[model samples]
Target chain A: MSENIAERVKKIIVEHLGVEADKVQDNANFIDDLGADSLDTVELVMAFEEEFGCSIPDDAAEKIRTVKDVIDYIQKQV
Target chain B: MRRVVVTGIGVLSPLGYGHKANWEALVKGQSGLSKIRSFDPTDYVSQVAGHVPVGREIGQFNPDEILSPKEQRHVDPFILYGMAAGQQAVQDLNWLPETEEEKNRFGVYFGSGVGGLMGIINSGKSVETVGPRRLTPFAIPSILINLIGGHLSIKYGLQGPNIACATACATGSHAIGEAARLIRDDRADIMLAGSSEAAICPVGIAGFSQMRALSNHFNETPQKASRPWDKERDGFVMAEGAGAVVLEEYEHAKKRGAKIYGELVGYGLTADAYHFTAPGGTGAKRAILQALKEADITPDQVDYINAHGTSTPMGDLVEFKAVKEIFDGTNVAMSSTKSMTGHMLGAAGSAEAVYTLLAMQNNVLPPTINLDNPEEETAGFNLVPHKAQEKQVTYALSNSFGFGGTNATLLFKKVLNET
Candidate 1:
């Protein structure tokens, strides 16, 4: 289940950034590796909210730095 | 100073398709407001508008009437309306100057407040449903403001300075003023100038509703809701339409034997910088004074004033005070065409300009419908109410102010001695 959640999160990141899904791994930083701008990051967070059926407040959204952080946040919320 | 004259006119108003129908309807005092049928507005606050009644059913209009099909699909509805109006204007003048050089000497300047809200809304829905990846490739091109001018330039093969202005509601007047300046500066011999708007969608309605800028009192009585200068006036009824005019140098138009409607004498633009969405009365007064000054005409010389009266409670009052200040004590014939057509946003300036021009041509000022009892806020002005007025309109001024505290006023003089 953990592996599947990570895969789904990676797919979302790659799709949002228009990057290769294989390149968006757990350690990949959204800004540094995926070339995502501030708006892209915010939109990514929104996508996460809709996909997981949970709310990510701005304070918590600020702490989400990498694909791994998003996965962990989703896991905790779920 | 170089003189600019309107050689041709075209419109796609709610009253009808062409200029004749629109002019007749205006003269006869016909209201275009109806129940919101384009979309379900039951959940929304503003439930009525001057929507294009047959837009969808008209589907994929013959671009040969304007341009080829391949070129038509790339632009937004505002641009489509602009192009169609521009085509009509060009055709009416038989303005196909024989060589490519003449084509290069003409340009297009158009405006739109919200470029392609329908396109944005449709693409946004796709993003919400099938995810962002399913977004169409034409999304960005269809929503940009400048593409209206770009498509017009391409369609007419115009190579001169083609530009688009987005001054919210003052956009059309700004476009016309800027295009006339180009003629004054000897940049272009002729300019296909006007504005278009197609923001009558779900998101468009919802955004305006959220701002409390639309009428919510009349779901059952849509026509009566847009009551300018009336005691019961609540708010403006949003409308969608476009108007275009062919502005050419007076000598050039005469040489071509084009029918000259009137000479565009002066244009004035001012910014209140006071509020984001509301008008400051003093700022509008300055705009009107500047226009009259630029036209080198006295206040009493003006015969008719086409008001920017959006029928909003505050907007109508501010404009009334502005007109009062400009005319000082003289009672100029003033009427808000928006009372009948509803507010057409960026296109309001040009639409009102067309009405002003027609009024000047026929010597009849169209009525400001729905003004039952003039409010105390709107005092000491001759607001032409209920019925059209016939008068020798030598000089007419049109005012349009927008959301960003932008204001534009245009002056037109009837051509008395043409021979």
Candidate 2:
């Protein structure tokens, strides 16, 4: 189930940011490594919430800075 | 107060792309109307429209040549057409603003009559048939009306007042007039002022046809659909397109060695305060007189007028009566290019304004083609019917009266030859 969450998180990141799928590694930082600005990060979180059927708070979204972090948050919420 | 001068022009009409193509088509008195190709039009009564050509004809629009795959998804065709004209105007001026101050001094006042009516209609139908979850995120941004100014300003990094006017068919004229005021009021040194429209869609066709505002009898001969001032005229032919101009301060443009097209000498805006759909004779006449007054010129000084003759039974006569009442004794050669290119709604005023400048430059008045038999009211004015005429035009005017009795008149002075 965690593996499925990781894959889904990577998919959302790729689709939302137009990034290559393989580059969305688990530990890659959204801003430093994935080339996301503040606006992009907010949109990515919204896409995650819509796709995963989860509601992320502002502080919770701020804590999610990588693909692995997004997966962990979604799993905890579900 | 800064005097506004037109240094560049961009056009995307049913006739073709850019100022040269549209001017050439206008001078040749060619019509761009045909059986509706954007949609089936099988269900609509008025099946004829002046759609912008997209195929490999001599002067057709090729979307692939303009926008990228990703950029195309973020905006509607209204934005695309407006951007194309804005890009052309920028390129024509060869303007490269490298400083933040230069960017801040440049602005865009572009507008449209409707807010992506076709895009909204298409998506609304899709949502009903396919559900809300199927809608794309870009749908909302793409449907917003003011995105033309937003998109064009972002593309060129113009940081001044980005305004959007939505005064029905008078949107373009109001945009130009307002932008010129912005320059005159020392708010901006330059402005990209105009409008765009691509409403040749299912709803646009049905809505206009239901109101009996579009030409229908000439479906078999679509080229003759928009016969303005002619007795055979039934209604306006709906056309889809855009037009733009780079308006700059006169001394600033002169300093930059910009080739001035014309001078925006005056602008007049008024309201009917009488009717919603029907035009008010008093308001329209007052608009014309006000424009001439602001220009500090008498009615006789004007040589040509590109009329907002939509070819409708009431509108055509109403505009003629107004112009006649104002410039009755003046030898002003008036014509409506709408006879050939159809009425382009929000883009109509700017498009005709561009054509008016072209006429002043070419020194040849464009013919109001398909004017087989001019009505008695149209007989007094030199309606330049069925054939082009060479008139040493130095000053010209363009009128745009729209729904809700919104009236606007823009007067331009020839400025290229003086230097």
Candidate 3:
């Protein structure tokens, strides 16, 4: 389940930001490394919530900045 | 005052993709209108439209060449079409500002009759079904009328005056005329000016159909639906496209050895001040004569006219009567490319202006198709019906009238070597 979550997070980031799949590493920051603006970050959170069947509030959403952060959050919820 | 001349033109019209393709199709009297294919129109009153074909063919428009699939997902079709046409015009002009001063001296003036109507309508549906939280972050920028100019300015590093006029059908003409005024005032040396529109959506069709402003009589024979000045004409057919031109200061263009299509010597803008939807008074007449006055020429000096003939009963006849009143004795030939390209709304004026320049360049007037029985008022008028005519078109004029009684006229004089 953990490996599946990691693959899913990378896929979403690659599709949303139109970046290379290899660049969406667990430690790579969405803003600093992946080139996402504030709006794109917000949209990425929404996509994650829909995919995982869970809601990430605004306060929690602000903390999600990397592929690892999304995997950890979704793992805890599911 | 600096004079302005048209150096490059680009078009993405129902007739074709490039200006040359559109001009060839127009001269051959081909109809771009057909049963709506973008969406199912069986439920709507007016089911015909002139939509841009999508492919990699000779005249088809392929948006992938301009934007990636992900990038295009954020922007509306109107902006995409405008960007494509603007890029084509800039490339045609072969000028990209590399220096700070050159960038500062470049500008953009683009407009649209209705910007991103489909975007707004889809967002409204999302709000009702999935709520606003699911809406995309690029919603606001995608729907703004001025974003076309904004995107073009950013792409070319143009840092001069940037504006987008939203004067309905006259938006294109007003954008070009106002950009010329900027050059004439020495504000900018070069400007990309024109308009784009893609509002042939469900709500757009319903709105115009409710107002009885579309042709429903020939949905079965879609090509014949947009017959401007014809006795069987009912209303105009909506179209989606863009037309862009590179307008440069005459001296600047000449110094760069740029090809000048024609010189835009005069333009006139006026309002009827009478009704919201219907045209009134001598506004059309006054606008044309005012343009002639500014051109410093008499009525007989004019050769060809691209009329604001939108196939509607009242609009076509009123424009015809005005032309008759002004060019009664002159052997001026008039034609409505709308009879082929349909009514592109905001893009109509700019596309017709490009067509007028082509007419002067090729000395051939595009014809108004499907004029089987002309209106009685058009007895003595040379409406250039059914077939293209070859004539020495030295001076040409294009007219555009819009809702809220706005009118704009642009006069183009062929560039003779002596001048």
Highest TM-score: which candidate? 3
lDDT of 3 by residue, A1-78 (tens): 999988988898899999999898889999999988887898898889888889999999999877888899999999
| Model 2: TM-score, first chain | 0.94
lDDT of 3 by residue, B219-335 (tens): 999999999989999999999999999999999998888899999988989988988899888889999998999999998999999999999999999999999999998999999
- For candidate 2, what is the interface RMSD? 4.6
Model 2: per-residue Cα lDDT over B107-177, one tens digit each:
99998887688789878887899676556567788878788889888888999989999888998898999
**Model 3: docking quality category:** medium
Off by over 4 Å in 2: A1-78, B55-58, B416-419
- Give per-residue CA lDDT, model 1, range B357-392, as digits (tens): 999999999999999999875566778899999999
lDDT of each: 0.84, 0.86, 0.92
Top DockQ prediction, candidate number? 3
Task: Looking at model 3 chain B, report the run of 10 residues with the lowest lDDT sum.
Answer: B66-75
Candidate with better DockQ, 1 vs 3: 3
Candidate 2, DockQ score (0 to 1): 0.15
TM-score of candidate 3 relative to the true fold: 0.97
